[model samples]
Target: MQGAQRNSLRLLQWMMAASLALPIALFAIASTISYNSTLDIADREIERTLDVAHEHALKVFETIDRSLAELNEVVRDLSDDTIRSREPALHKRLKQLADALPQLKSAWIFDANGKSLVNSLASPPPNQSFADRDYFYSHVDQSIGTFIGTVLTPRPPYQGARFFGVSRRRSSDDGSFIGVIQASVLPEYFESFYARIGSDPGSFFAMGRTDGVLLAQLPRLDRDFRLDPNGQVGRSIAAHPVHGLMTIAWPTDGLERRIGYRRVAGYPIYVSAGLETSAIRGRWLTTISQHLVFGLPATALLFILLAFAFRRTQHLQLEAAKRREAEEALKHSQRLEALGQLTGGVAHDFNNLLTVIRASVDLLNRPQLSEERRQRYITAIGEAVARAAKLTSQLLAFARRQTLKPEVFDVGERMRSLRDMLATLLGPAIEIVTQLPAEPCLVSADAGQFETAMINMATNARDAMQGKGRIVFTVHAATSVPDTLAHLSGSQTLKNPGFICVTVSDSGVGIPAGQLGRIFEPFFTTKQVGQGTGLGLSQVFGFARQSGGEVTVVSEVGQGSTFSLYLPRAPADLLPRSPAPTTAPAVAGSGMSVLVVEDNIELGNFAADGLTELGYSITLVDNATDALTELVSHADRFDVVFSDVVMPGMTGLDLAQAMCDRCISVPIVLTTGYSQALSQDGIAGFELVQKPYSIEELSGVLHRAARVKRVRDGAAE
Candidate 1:
């Protein structure tokens, strides 16, 4: 045993270690992947910036080259003396071409002697000698096509800003080198344009010569800058020749940067754009740290939980014993709690009804009461009894044990019928709106129960709105259960192909979120004392579930609330093709006999007395067993057996079954205020009338059942 225990402990430790390591490993892998992705994004952004700069540089250089070419054509074979003779015309033309481009500082035509013959800046031309200039000397050697010179500030005699020249060699038809026609581009113009195109701090853009001369740069240097011949940028250019991305420490600031460089199509210049390496890394760190911020705490919490679990495992046997005890205690407490609530609610509602009845009875006993006052008190007593019956019915409904008589009915039609009733119930202050589908939406449910549920919901809505808002009734067909009710709509409970939604929406003071879940509880109410019974929504909830559907609610405080009752969709064929024959009022019992079975003596005597006055011979039994014995012994005497369903011994349903077992043929009619047995098993082919039924209703039921029995008996004979 000791060895086994030791091994178990070791296994648990290993498992916990593995659990802890797994997430850390996965997190590390995810962080690395995310970092790489961030870096790749940074590189791409830099490359795009480089492309923009490259295009700008290419356009500026192309304009200068074209302008220089056009000037070359003008003085292709002209001698220096001839160019000087037409200097006035050439100077004006040069200035016009130069001024056309914002980047260009000036344009010039020089002769073989290296002296400016015509210049855009001065109409008569400056006496400037460029014989010693690198651009001129380079062109003097042979026809170089285009010569790009290094950046230079103007000499004292020629006062101007720093600029670089883009010159084309003017050669004779014999291929002899002539003076160059040059366009001077302002470096500061490129610098200013680069500034206009926004870039992050530590980011830089530069136009440089492939030979490593930096012509113009944002974050301008104190003097001209150049790349080392063997540096990172120089080597990358050599390797790629046209375009590439690189990371290098900038020579000016010694800050590391990730750069993208592209060479101009036919020029010596390369345009590069870069973001500081530190900034790129910082962004990547921020992302990873954000993940860590959440990941670290979660991992720590997991570790703590594991440690607690390990500690608990050491006392597993002790905890198992304690947990069982706690659970049993908890279950017992919950049962008591539920019973207490049910008992309290029942007592509270019934006491109120009894109070009204008691007060009305006291008033009726007045010695000097007038006939009108006496009649009013009687009416009040009757209403109180009816309300008491309704209270029990609602309680049964909330318990999901209300016996229902389901029929296929069109929800749209029912809603249409309720409009007048709703208007009267809600009063003139509340507006009612109906949105019904054009097609009939049929549902299989008790029509009376559905109407009651709707009324309950509407009353709740009216109360929620404080009685001055709009109530909308909408009926629509749905293919499946709503998400809110999906978990509760089990397969056995809801096995229908479709459902119909009867929704009641109101603009009112909405239910609070904390109270929503408890709103359906039997005794739970947000209303103040005497304002409500708190069983209204409970009844709606029960009716829907008992009818193979679900009820759902959505609300926001101070806005409104919506309640939807979903029922199984019924096919049109389920509805009777013809209307059921209405049972006419049976004013008299006509010498018929009824065996009245009721456990309550007062109710039994009342039923017997009422039927006796209706010309029926009544045999009253206090229990279903005695009723069964009476049916067996003198079964021929009773035309119909009227019995209360809920009794002390054999229930009305059982008694009916017993008579059928004995092959007794008598029309049995069952009635109940509420019965769990009838709710679960249903009426089993017997006529049923709910309790507190009127004399006219009971008489009609007896007549119908006895007539059907008589017809069947005649057929048998």
Candidate 2:
């Protein structure tokens, strides 16, 4: 037993040593490799710096060459016989050319005798002769038409310092020589270029001409336009023709630098760049050292603690795994709850769509052909279309696709408008009463959605009454309620601060006690399947919640049901409500050409035909793609583009953008069956008409569109 114990102890010792030793050995090797790799990278970076300097020098030379070429062209033009014959015209052209050339400080033309003809300066010297100047005399004999000579300041009216001259001898159509046209470009332009190239906070660059004259230097040129020739970098560059790099300790800052240099291939200039090596690599080295200094001891302690804590962690991990399983189950339950609510909302919208279609078809089947009969049929179709629009709206609401156009509207006014509809919808047996405050009770919400919710709740109440009870609708302004009932009804349970409340009550069969909890569970209904899809209460719940409020029901099986809705109140100043238009205005077509862009072939054709019949000229296109093509090809042809908002390939918004890109200024009227898609951003500067609109609505939108187009066009003119 003693022998076996000794062997087991020995094996454990070996295992601990092996685990700890491996990482330490690997870390040492890794640190060595990293240090060497950083050195190699530094070398490559020095090479790159040299290449960059060389490229910058070449660019400077190219700028000089281009300036010379431009100057030569101008000089040649001034010396032409055609320009000289028209002396006044020639003077204007010279001034214009001088103003255009940013690199040249000034320009001048001279006769063969070197008398100044025109100078860009405000005043010209009485007599200035450049006949003895090198630029003129050197090119005087050569067949070469142009020459870029050594820099020399021009005589009076142009002189301040030496300038590079580009001179050309001009010949007329008969090959007779004309006076010399010379242009001088200032050296200060090249100095500015060098300044920009070396503007980096840590860098400086300087250039020397082929003859060892410094043309430009950053940190400003000295009196002789030269960098400190005795400096280590300057001496090295002047001595070596081959490119070179070296790390030097900057004398002033005490920071190490990587300095590099290369001679520009075609130019006589040598370029140099220096970057602070310590600034670039010091931080990284310091970080590595910090980790190494602390890590060794920390790692040793961690290994010891981990071995001691192993058994405890094993027990805790088991418990944690079980807890995670419980959480997953809870999340699954939440998902099921959300899915149930969604299903109910979808069913409600589908039923509403079916109701509209059924009503419309029934209207078309009317047998009598009297004028009154035809009018009634048309009205019925209109009502059905309005209902279908409501169905799509509800679908969008359920999907969270609808954007609310919140405006302050008086709750009382909206309720008053529905009184007649309420009477007919409730039938003769139910007594409907409205109790509203004389003062407006206003709330911020989409007026249409709010009205629809009210109608839905009223209809549900009427059904529950079974045609023989009194229903009361009341609106009031209220303060916060206690949390107890608030929690029960899921009312804005936090704190109302203040609110507007609308309540609808029916004295009839109330919801069962057991089923009250599931009243908003969409499709969970006691009614016959064909009688109702059970989305009424669900929609009420969603709409109330989405509008920053809540809907609550208080019911007793034998008594009655009361459904109260809470809405956040609007400020007093925001309470005004616009009255609904009492009657449709006379339909008058604006005399303007209209382009109808709709992807639905039948709908597009119907709209075109209908507009034509209403006395408006119409052009029809199937989609935004074809519409854009037509606009591009014939931009001035259309006055207004009446387009469906949602189409395949390209949306109406895309078409609008394309028109703007092409600078085609025309009014656009966007129409859609899906009003949810016509949010604030979609309707900027354009008129929006809901789909299934009557001829009157179409004409109204067209008139508005035409007026807007005229105003815009007049402004342009």
Candidate 3:
């Protein structure tokens, strides 16, 4: 019996060891996987950075080549009989071209005898002959359109500096060699252009010839006119493709580096951009060290603690749950960071707005205020209120809780009306063009909000072009819409239901692709300080969502941007419609009875007071239950039921449904600051007024509601 007990103890010891070993192995595997994933992300980030640089450099080179091509065409034209006969006229034209093109140093014409005939410079180079030059010899027997070559020294008249010559062969009408028409571009010009890109420290940004000659390098470089083909870099270029990225040790310094190269198309030059590998991996190495400092020790300590608690099943389960819990914590941290950023920016903006309001109020309280000062204070108060209202509207839009007053109108007519306003706003430098269709393209949306978005777009374009460019507004009816969406659902839908698209296009610097996803985020501005509020696009987004529509943008850097607001089409109205009135006679309210239901005590009191002051009898209640009770108890006392849409226990929508079920005749008018019912289209059978309504605005809406209520009461009777 004692020997049997010893065997059981020995078996149990082996089982315990196996259990501990399994967890240790899992921890090791998980750590390795996490490290590799992080490394992959770092590599992707580096590649993306290289891509941005490549695109920017491409644009610069294209611009330069375009200018050079323009001159090349002119030089080709100079080979004609009419132009050559008027040598003086040709020289003047070449000088004008050189003056316009900053990169071109001088332009000259060489005769069939290789003698410099017509020179662009005021004082022409003396006794210039190119009989021995490669450019002259190369083109003497050929008809090269745009031949590029390097110049080492002045072969007489070229008497200034080492430069690049972009030459075209000039030929006679009989196809005989008539020498070369060439333009000189100094090496310093290309070097200065590369210096402006703000490359990293110790990394080289260079423009080199395809023949392995480095023409220009930022941070200064001096080398022989021709690079040695026997060098390591020359061999690498020969071994690699025209454009590529490579990681290798520099033969000159023995430092490991990552290099990117792009061969210019239709030219003999290429650009190389590189960064030291050590600099790229510096942050990654730091992260690994931090993991070693904290992660390894914590992992070991947790393993030991688990060993002690091996007998407890609950403790093991708790440890198992912690992995998922940590994942959730990481997601929560990201959410909190975004929230924190928004709140911090909003706080600063609100403080500035409040300072204006506070100062204006203080000034108004003065005992003997002059009329001018009082007017100034009042204007200041009005402006501050307007700005605050716009700020709140933007915040509500980003949160997808904004209220929209939708109406059917011709978007084309709206753009026509805005042309003048946009012109003044964009100033004299920007031209405003409207492409309005002859027939009406009608859409259902808040006309005011749509107009605001147009104005915002115009302003943004003005800034993008530094107040000099063109803005075009195009209105059209689209047969097919790609989607309709609220913020959370990234769902896609396709249909031919159709939509009215109002596109605002600008000939200005475009938004970066990386920032397109965040352009609608509140308080996120690319503009300089004090130039913008960053709420413009967000308000447009909010209006689109609230009105059951969508917005999209297309942009390319250096090209421009286009913002399209697509609104679902309304049912086509048959009769000719009257235009929306800018102003209407004020409607005063009589002693109409109203029941106000609001959850917040402060807001309820404020609403009650405002209604009473507007010459209406008002009764206020807290929740939907209390509101229902009041309506039932005193049915005949109230003429209009005014209720907030959001409430505890029973919501305003639920209460509305209950009233309908019970067959109550009184008309229901819903008011909401924000409600899920608003976003999901739950307020179907009532009129609504957005928050921050004044006594006059409230009175107007109340009078309209009372008329409908009276009609309902008469029908019931």
Candidate 4:
């Protein structure tokens, strides 16, 4: 029996070892796959950056070539004597051409003997001889079709700024070598343009000749630098001929980079661009580290639990139950943690706004305050209140309980109108690209909130790209939310509806995988402190869910991110009709009798006094019960009921229902700071004006409600 027990122990030991080994092996395989995938993604990004640089360089070269050709036309057949005769006209023309093109430093027509004929820099052109210049000699043999010469400083009588010439051979009818028409291309011009594209550290842009002479480079070198004929760029150009990508150590700094090189279509020039390999590897390492941070610990814990269960097979069921209980407790704690974060974030923001108002009020209360300072303080107070209101609105949005005024409108039209506004907001550095379909994509949603959500998403994209890169807005129809987002919270609304998907895609440093799940959570941001409030995406998520749809995102670290906002489609019949313009007199209380139901004494008094001032005969009550009693007893005396939604004994909605049951004819208008019932079920067909309303707003709503009541009573009569 003892020998059998020893055999069982050995068998259990083997099972535990095998279980741990399996998971460890699987982990190893996953890491390997991830590493290779990261490298591939890096390569693709390098190639993309290279393509942009190549196109920009090609345009610059083409501009210079065009200028040279235009200059060639004028001086092609002109003899040295004739050119000198028209020297003043040629000089003015050259100056105008150079001024027209930002890339051109100057334009020159060199004589066959290498003497400067009229140039753009000076009239009665300087007696400079370019016969000794390489450009002049290269064109002497035969037309090389716009030869791109090496970088060189202009000789005496001109600025020392380095320039490379784009020269065309000015030949006679016999094809004899005559003179050269050159557009002096400023290398600094290209460098300045490159600086605006992006400035990621360790990233570089370079233009070089096929023979390996460097023309210009960003992160400009102090002294002229040349590339070896067998260097990475030269070899890559020779091997691929047109465009390709490779990894190499930069000759000047010895920093390794994943470079993409492309040869200009009909020029000997090549453009290369890349980010340092170290930066790419650093991003990869961060992703791997995040995985290990979570995965390793969880794996170890899992292995421990399995081993413990194997050793205590008799108590396995009880242990399993305990483990389940622990998991439940853990989930509960996580929920509490989220709640705490929400509460803390709200409190912190509200406190800041309140502090602003409080300080402004204190300053205003001083009797000796200057007129300018008083106006400033008042303005500050108003702004603070506005900010506070916006914050509460955002919080309501996150809770999916904000009161929205939905209307059926074309989404495409709205975006078209909003594009220019967004362009101004994001600034000139960021490019806004649109892919709106020709057909109108109509939806029933709050147009104001829709614009706000679009702006929020665009602002987030701008931040992710560090104020530069592309923000593409694509609008299309989707039968349903993507399957990948079907399991996300608040996505059930999108399951059975045809939706319009508005996608915002950005090419920026992307979100980390671990943080993607929590990005929409209120007040949770990846941006550094003071940079973001983290409520932008939360509002987006809330708006989508509230509008009967969902927002989904797909991101990859180092590649960029795309956010898809789905909004339910409106039926064709729901399209809004434009009503004819009316010249009716402005709405006012006009002695209309109003029964005001407000629980707060001060607020009730304010309403009563404000309405009285606006020509309304007001009856104020503390609760819906008293208001209902007064209204039922003297229903004919009051023309309208102005009531707060939340009150003691009976709510405003309940009071409205009671009045309806009793066959009361008074029109009821409801107001609320916030009400879950009103937000979820709406005002039950009653006119609603939000809380802290102006006297004008309250009077207008009251007069409109009374007018409708009068019209209905007259019709019944």
The weakest ten consecutive residues by lDDT in model 1 span: 331-340
lDDT of 2: 0.67
Q: Compared with the true structure, what per-residue lDDT tens digits does model 1 show for residues 27-80?
A: 889878987997899888888778778888888888788888778888886888
TM-score of 2: 0.41
All models, RMSD in angstroms:
24.6, 35.4, 42.0, 42.5
Clashing pairs in 1: none
Taking the tens digit of each residue's C-alpha lDDT, what string does model 3 give over 1-717? Answer: 345545654555555675557656865675677557655654554456545555655554455456555644665646435445666776787788778767667777777767766767744435556766665677887776666676455554346767666676777667788777777766666566656553545465666677866666654565344655667667777777476667766544567766667776677776776666776666455666676687667666766655554545445445646844764464344334333434455566678779999999999999999999999998987777766665565555433423466777778877876564455456668888888889878777777677767766666777888889888888888755654444313322333246778888898889999999999886678987756656667767877777667888899999999988888766566324684552354454478898888898998898788778767888888898988888788878888888888787998888888889888767788887667767777669588867755555666777888898778768989
* Residue 505's lDDT in candidate 2: 97
Cα lDDT tens digits, model 2, 42-130, are 55665665576577557645654554456446556554344445555546655666677665555566676766666556333356677
Task: Give lDDT per model, in order.
Answer: 0.81, 0.67, 0.69, 0.80
Question: Which runs of model 1 end up more than 4 angstroms from their true locations?
Answer: 1-20, 77-79, 196-198, 307-717
User: Could you tell me which 10 consecutive residues in candidate 3 have the lowest summed lDDT?
Assistant: 487-496
Candidate 3 structure lDDT: 0.69
Task: Indicate the TM-score of model 3.
Answer: 0.35
Question: How many angstroms is residue 61 displaced in model 2 relative to the true structure, after the best TM-score fit?
Answer: 98
TM-scores of the models, in the given order? 0.42, 0.41, 0.35, 0.40
lDDT of 4 at 122: 89
Residue 83 CA displacement from its true place in model 1, Å: 3.5
